[model samples]
Target: MKLFQYDNFPQVTGSRVSLRQILETDIKDLIEISFYDAIRAETVQQAAEMQSKINQDYLDGNSIHWGIVDNANHNIVGTCGYYRGLDKGEGELGCVLLSQYYGQGYMTEGMSLAIDFGLHTLGLKRIWAATGQQNGPAIKLLERLNFVKTADLNDDEIEYELQK
Candidate 1:
């Protein structure tokens, strides 16, 4: 349980969502669920390609990614991951949800799972997240998760940090 030490992204389950590795069969759902993700894919091929690169990062021992699947319908609703900070005992947190699933507490539960894994299983001393100041829901979600507003990176971007 050290930084960047996991080979396979562990699967975690919550009442509403399950966090697990995004599989090849999930590319279609991944494309549909991605909205606020840094990489957007309009087609399954594109999503597969993007995920291949991400999977490579994980294999290279540099990153960790999880697909947020709703347990009810068993469909992917979002994604979440940790960007390792080398051996610094910290990682950056990131997540994105399909617009249709917003305000339903899905991301909240999803993030809570990721946060617990990052802190307890991964042994990270801190998990930091950055979001646009205009993203009210994300800001509220972070606050609700007990992540403290730590800094304003710029006029538009703000950063929050959670520690254990």
Candidate 2:
């Protein structure tokens, strides 16, 4: 599929959180996540590599990443976005939030807005999300959004697809 290029990016928000395109100003937030051990423990990846991957994704047309911010405190508490791959009109959703915000449902709100932008604005037909089978919260969120499990790709990971 061809890459979708935009001269300007868009911002999405909800009552508890707001999402803006990742910018240089957001680097500090990324750095903070890089040093958060809990994030690494949950995702099973090192910070340096993950940080580099985030930056590279912005430079390339392979993904659109955003800063998920806490509205009341105005602090960036997580990251979310659609990685550009798979098939045309299809994308993937993933997010990493600070441990403190786990039970607040902030991530769910951010992702719902993202899904709307992908479908209504970006003209996406299908969006899929993959998560470790052991990650109950993620699986539940995807299921809540009606993303169906297609198969077990490997290990504890399951693939989900949303067709428009």
TM-score winner among the candidates?
1
lDDT of 2 by residue, 1-164 (tens): 33666666668878888988665555654664553322442232454456567656655666777888888988787888887553476788777777777878888888888899888877787888888989998888888887899889877789988755
32-78 per-residue lDDT for model 1 (tens digits):
65432465678877888888888877777667889999999998888
Work out the TM-score per prediction.
0.88, 0.79
Worst 10 residues of 2 by lDDT: 35-44
Per-residue lDDT of 15 in model 2: 84
Instruction: Supply candidate 1's per-residue lDDT for 97.
Output: 91
TM-score of candidate 1 versus the correct structure, residues matched by position: 0.88
